[model samples]
Target: MTEKEWNGDFDPMADPEEQKTLLSVLDSLRSYRRLAHFNSTHVRRQAFYSLPSQHWTLLSQPPFSVLDSLSKLDDLIDSNAELAEAIFLEGFKAFMAPSLDSEWVASIVPEKYAHDEYQIYSIVMDHLNVQTTQGDMDKARSCVNQFYREWSAEGNMERGKCYEPIINALYTEFTARSQDILDLDKSDLKVLVPGAGLGRLVFDVCRAGYTVEGNEFSYHEIMASSLVLNHTDKAGQFNIAPFALGCSNHLSRADQFRTYSIPDVHPRSLLESEGTEEKVPPYERMSMATGDFCVIYSQPSYKGAFDVVATVFFIDTAPNIIRYVEAVRNCLKPNGLWINLGPLLWHHASRIQCSGDENEENNDDLKYHGHIDAGVGDPGSVELTDEEVVALVKHFGFEIERHEPGSVETGYISNRKSMLQNTYRASFWIARKK
Candidate 1:
């Protein structure tokens, strides 16, 4: 066949080779633009909006279009940004309709998860609205209390059993990496696990002879972690040591978790009781360190206190990524370490599928109840990405030590038919304050 004849019938759009070449060129250009834009604060903010718009335009266009568009944009921006922006833009357009700032009630929950989400979203929205309008701090506090009480009443009974394997995998990866760099024998070495869900990592660190504390914003998470650390065989099976629980008198120096109540305060009656004076032993057994931890407060500020801070699967949980990193950076001491793990850009969507059995119908209600208890509505609530996370952290004066894309997998398994096996590939970063 003649070269011209062969070329005559060729369609560039249909050719994978041609498409790949064009994509590479576009990607190279985008990368250069991103670096240039990021270096300038003004340009970066503009880039954020423009890039998302461009993605929407491209994604809104043909066959394999959504996936293709994502692939193209993913090459240009960070994954977290891509995922978050996509979810926000799509969900906002559908739900918000007129104003970006307007509140949106979900129209339909994924068929499988609808009832569960409906109840949770209803309570949470009511709580949010009430909190927004009430000038009375006391009233607001009461509202918050009521919200949690209602949530917990449902959550305790129907919440799916914690997936032990995923937790173990996460712990294994975290400890292995941490031990490589951290000198545990350096007495008075302190670590902070901000948003230390369920105390898995904190428990492990204490076991490793490092005095560690967890800082969690949610009272539910704190209580859950306390139970897991204090009551479970997992702690004994792992032979993890406990940190010395300090009393109110030890106020001069106290680790984050040990020093404060999980909710930071209890009901006045609970506070006024005789039992309130009883000191619970610190969750772990460890020597009294003379100094405080280099605190890591994920998505919030503990400001200028920690020697080391670590947030695993944390940045994405922030409603505002930039604000979250600033808070985390503010908590770290000068030259302190910051470690992060988990997917940079991702969103969880609920979808219903038929289980093909009448017995399985009740499982749907249980799942729905769990969602209500956990308060899982709205797309923008928790959205962030690796690039944005890095950028935000750097904005707070952290120098990147290492960044690995797709570094870890959370192996989650469940015998419960209702539980979905979701695999997460996460980015890992270790940064130090400049």
Candidate 2:
């Protein structure tokens, strides 16, 4: 459907905070549509040298065959561009539909969320083209990478390393806590996954006979996940080249250009063995929620609401680690389990920067301050050592039933064929509310 002109409208939402968040997500998804351009620009710049540096002798060198190699490279880049476009386009179509902007945003606000004066901004895809930034491109790239990491068959190796222990540990906790579903329509067993990137882990947990909610903060991720979790019709229904935009440390060019058929298994077929397709037979077990992990789960409504709180590759995102611990403790039932698997790669500890209108912005406001690298003062992150985090967990009324430090080694969205690989020796832990 054709988009109505933006009119630069500043429509008001009942809740200003939620309105701001929705706009932020919309902005992120809109920028995603420009992914092909961002990557092509980078690939071309990396593959070519300055014209001034190339003299006739060098250009015409017989052994090198510069033109021949470049000709082939150009062909590959073309393929890469096509693949990148397809990946972003397919992932974004559902969310970016013009109808979604008005309907979804307008419906944002339930009762009890209100603002006397709310001002929210909206950006159409055409306007996003004008406002695209390197940051937006970086986020777009992450969305593509998440497709493989969360849904593709090739990503199973890494997912196994990071996700298996949580599943197994939860199994022990679920059996210990609740013997039967409270309601046939609704399972008494409830699991909450924080930092639930792309909803894959939530899907897995839901398949284990527990109702699970995947909560995420990144709009790019929310859009990407919602696309597949809801829209995909069959196994391997979506295809993407996650590594196509990469320009460094490749063992072979083929590695970077490889295509992946996403979601090796159909989400609907979660429990084939039981004859029921979904873990919750009617597909009611799996759910997705979008917002800050600390803010959403810390609410009164969520207190003691979950049988298990699972964090996977997520704790390091906290500005203050204590807030994370508090929120987890707050939401779990007495003797509820908190299972975690991740490296403490403190996401907020990046070098700080204050630029332009952002000079007054708080460092914890990751939308602007995240990867920028200038400025002085504190980076505004409370980064804890592995030991510190473990002790912190214990301090917050959790008994260390299990703790395996640096045990699971895995990569996030890694190219298996890349010569240089960055893998994390993630710690795995399961603690009970004491």
Give the candidate number with the greatest TM-score: 2
Model 2 spans > 4 angstroms off: 1-35, 38-124, 127-130, 177-187, 269-282, 350-364, 367-380
Cα lDDT over the full model 1: 0.39
lDDT of 2 by residue, 1-434 (tens): 00210111122233544344444444544444344544554445455554556653476466645555444444554543333344344433433443346555445543343331111122233333343345555665677667788888888998988888888887766565444544332256688888777788887876666787777666566556665665567888756667655557876656766778777887655444442644355255567665556666777988998888999988887767888898899899998889998998886775455665764344334642122222112245678899999999999899999898988889888887888889899998889898
* Residue runs of model 1 more than 4 Å from their true location after superposition: 1-184, 232-302, 345-382, 412-421
Q: Name the TM-score of candidate 2.
A: 0.75
- lDDT per residue for candidate 1 within 122-229, as digits (tens), equals 333333322111112222122222222112322222111222222343354346556777642422445666656544455444444445656553322332333333
Clashes of each: 13, 1
